[model samples]
Target: MPDPERDIASRYREHTGRKRTYILTGFVLLVVTAVLSIAVGSVDIPPQDVVRTLAGYSVSTNWDNIIWNVRLPQVLTAIVAGAGLAVTGMVMQSILRNPLGSPFTLGISNAAAFGAAFSVIILGAGSTSSRVGDAVTINNPYTTTIMAFLFAMLVTAVILAFSRFRGTSPEVMILVGVAMGSLFTAGTMFLQYFADDVQLAAMVFWTFGDTARASWEELGLISAVVAASVIYFTFNRWKYNAIDAGDETAKGLGVNVEKVRLVGMMFASIVTAIIVAFLGVIGFVGLICPHMARRIVGDDHRFLISGSIITGSLLLLSADTAARIMMQPYQLPVAVLTSFLGAPTFIYLILKGRRI
Candidate 1:
């Protein structure tokens, strides 16, 4: 007879150990990295002040304002946006079974950008953004963000419908997104050409992502979305792991393969849309972070997914901090720095994979 007591004890131990490794590790890393982000800024406000300010204690208004208004929001935007992008990439990879699957490759980000551009450019919600450095600041930032998110959902729905006919083949779905992305890019170029100098300038700045403008209100919305995604994805990790094996295998295992893919696709699109809308087009982190996490924790989404979230948040926060400090009195686009780091690392991974 199987030793029931021994089996139960072993299972319990394994469960606790996994929780510690995945959940505890993620929590610790997030806290440490968050502090590092808080400390590294233009005007140094010690960690104590940051905590004190958060605790409803009084501090210098200048220090208070800079910490609360500027660095805090930027740090949060980077973390939330990074985590969202990374998890979305992982989900796309899960369902598509393609290593290159990401918001960029799948055209979700581009689609969201196109929607935002239409609102500002064609419809004139704020100002026509067609050229470089031409930013059409609108009365409501969230209004433009909502438009991007909704449009991205529309695009995802179309992709889902196509995928049903396409038999969920990674190649077919991703190829369609690629063709769609090209079309969107062409449209953006046409708009830029027709735009005058001012609008062109505004368009340029937007294409490159910037985290400097993140505010408390924006942070609240972004955090809520990302936090919910993290939780939802966490519970759904096993389903993702099954899908990774193969859709047929997942279905044989009693998984609702299509439902899972549809839901994952929906959530992933929501994530990409929200991040792209507010943060602009930050590129490559989504692709890089998931690969990095998978390399560290293997293909199991339980650990790999949570690890991706924490690592992405850390990487972006550090990168954004560097962007701020690298050029005194000037802020560079977060996308530029992320691309620099993410692209090289991604290339390294590809080479490493081939060698192995």
Candidate 2:
């Protein structure tokens, strides 16, 4: 007969080794993609010069300015935003126990878009007008961002309020999200109807989810929020694991299922709102990255969350890099690329009968 002790030890070793390998591979890919994203913009900088510039070595003034002022900030924004969205998605799916649950599914993005539209159309924020011979002038650049954040929080508040009474039922939450999403989308359309050409254009552009719009200051804020959210999620990893196994089971294990779900939803919503407010509605990163990470790291939250972060960063950076080069002088929306990439993977998973 086989030795039971040796068999257990061997399996444990294999499991731990695989998890480490996944994490290491993800980290390497993230670094490589970040470097490529910084170097391969409209104004190409060589890989070596990109490294030298980052290390505080003197390069040409123009190259240094381009790397420091333009590309690096954009790349970092993509990285952080991607990681945030992915983690938030994982939390949402786990807490809600729904395969399709995501920040978008919760209607946060739609609400943010409505808020942005309201700012542009009603508040006359981010509006530009040109006289027959005059140049266009933009007014109230921060208005859309502030409005988006506020509106997103409002939606989250509403959801949480309903959940408080409904007892965190996944079906209830999903239905509430769908209803809220419809309401917000209708509101956005109403605003668009009243918008002028310039205001309409501004609203449309804001929804494209471009990382190029993020300033260093904005990136700094995003970094802080994402870091805090990640830390919170990490601390609550065991709670999430329990929550994922079904609420009754979790309750039997002495987990406060309702409270954990409510708190997780709030954190996920806030992180999602921050990203959407800054970058507009970048979808599917949250939906797809979590599933990808789950496949790689399995259901354990400790490895799964880290894997999601790294995979998300790698996916978004690669997509953004492709967006930059695909059109040469003109760039496409990173959201478009992500949707195109994610949709197929989603369908394949469904067809394969994989448990998402």
Candidate 3:
């Protein structure tokens, strides 16, 4: 007869090895997608040219400009924003014990939308410029981004404050988040109702999440925050894994369940707030990527976290690339494509009955 202990050890090793392979495959695909995104834009620079341009050798000034000034920044933004949103979503789902938990689940996206509309309509930061043929333009993006960040953080603050008084149970947090989302949606509608044609157009435009809007400066800030968040999450991976077993079980395992949940939620919210403020609410990435990673890697936070990051970056980068080339002169919003991709995949996941 086979030794039972050896059999179990072999099975464990095999499982771990498969997860590692999946993660490595995902990261390789993510890099390929990033390269394709940089190369397959309106002008369609060759992959060789892209590599040369990136490596400080100029193929031509025009290719160099397109690669460096336009496609590179957009691709970088998608990778960073995708990673941040996906990781945050995974953390929220684990900590809150809710399959539906995401950055937007806590009302951050809706609140940021309200703040952006306020700046566009009330503050007159966004206006239609006749010089650009009445195209909507944000005259002061700094004000809009700042306001959006503040309002998103406000929603987080409310949730945190409530958690202080009431216990940090998953049910209570989900209920509060849904209520807050509804409140902010109503406020955004109220602002839209009073706006004129120009302001109304601007507000609507701001809601369409676009990675093209980010510059190197904005990308730097996003990268810094996301890098820091990834570090924190990595350090607390074991605690999250323990908590996933169940609250009481986690406490028995010496995990400070409440503190871990609270701190994890706060960091996730900050990542969400910063991304929404700059990118204007790239939906579905935060929600779907975690589930996709979970389906592949199982509940172990070790593989799941890195899996989510790679999956998120790959999905968003592919969507952004499609958005750019779908319309020659006019690009669609990245969020629109993400919703298209996410909805069907989400329905498929439901049909398959994959658990969180």
Candidate 4:
């Protein structure tokens, strides 16, 4: 008869190997779905048209413009935002040792929203009807976006500062993050209340977050940032897992827990800023993806980070596609669809924590 312990170990090894295979499969799926995303739309462009357009071949001018200028940006935006948020979620969960720990947990999104709020409401200037003499006013979307990113870091810094002087207990961190989130969100609500109708409209769209404003320029900027972040986190995967074993153990094992936490938080904040600035605040993703990934990959960041990223990217892209197709002429907000799907999953995870 087969030894039971050896059989069990063999089965565990097989399961681990199987997860790695699924991860590779997921990457393939992400690429195929992304290509499909480019092809399926109101003006259905064939696969050849997509390839030829990339090769600078002549197509209908309008179709080419739509393909190169519109769909490409949306595709890239979704990809980067998905990947960045997934890695951020993984890092946060690892650091805090809590599955629910995310950029949202630290109130970073609320702070970013507050910054966007100030830019829209506090800086709303009257549009002069150019009666041949009046100069046009141009608001910088990039600047407002930069503000959102910076404010996220600012909130993170404050949290770190508070945590620095005091011992870092999980409960203390959670309480602080909750309090800060409440304060920033309250501030945002106040700004929204006094916002002019036009400004309010802009903020409402942003708060809900669609890819309506995604353009090639923003895509290029956001992609570069996301790529850099992925490289950093990707190479440092082992450090993330070390933190989960606690700081002292991490230190004895040659991991600089404080430095890792600090660097991890910085990269995590940067990812949050870029995604929010580019896609608006897409929620429940940063909260859920990491846990699901760990559950699948067994808490190894080396595989878990990559798995979470692939799974997260697929989840968002599929959601975005559904949003586009489901509403016909009008597209639903990407954030809305994600939250709808993500909330139930998050709740189930909470219920399933014991199993984890």
Q: Candidate 1, TM-score vs. the true structure?
A: 0.87
Q: Candidate 2, which ten residues in sequence have the lowest lDDT sum?
A: 129-138
lDDT of 2 by residue, 273-297 (tens): 9889988889899998989888888
lDDT of 4 by residue, 1-356 (tens): 55576768787788778888979998999988887887877778887778678778967898888887877777767777777788788887887778778768888888888877777777762232333311222256766687778888788788778778775555656677788889989998999899776677666666676665677777777778777877888887888777777777778889877667667777787778777876688987777777777777778877888888887788778888788778776677789999999989888987987664
Off-target runs (Cα >4 Å) in candidate 2 are 1-5, 128-138
- Candidate 4 stretches with Cα past 4 Å from truth are 1-17, 55-59, 125-139, 167-172, 350-356
* Model 2 TM-score (2 dp): 0.94
Model 3, 1-356: lDDT tens digits are: 55576778888898899999999999988887887789896688888888888999998999988888899999999999999999999999999998888889888999999999999988899987754322677889989999999999999999998999998988777888889999999999999999998889989888889998999999999999999999999999999999988999999999999999999989998999999999898999989999999899988999999999998998899899898888866788899999888899988888896454
Runs in model 3 deviating more than 4 A are 1-7, 130-134, 354-356
Q: Which number leads on TM-score?
A: 3
Models ranked on TM-score:
3, 2, 1, 4
**Models sorted by lDDT, best on top:** 3, 2, 1, 4
Instruction: Point out the worst 10-residue segment of candidate 3 by lDDT.
Output: 128-137
lDDT of 1 by residue, 47-74 (tens): 8777788677868888778777777788
Q: Count the backbone clashes (under 3 Å) in each candidate.
A: 12, 0, 0, 0
The pairs that clash in candidate 2 are: none
Off by over 4 Å in 1: 1-19, 125-143, 353-356
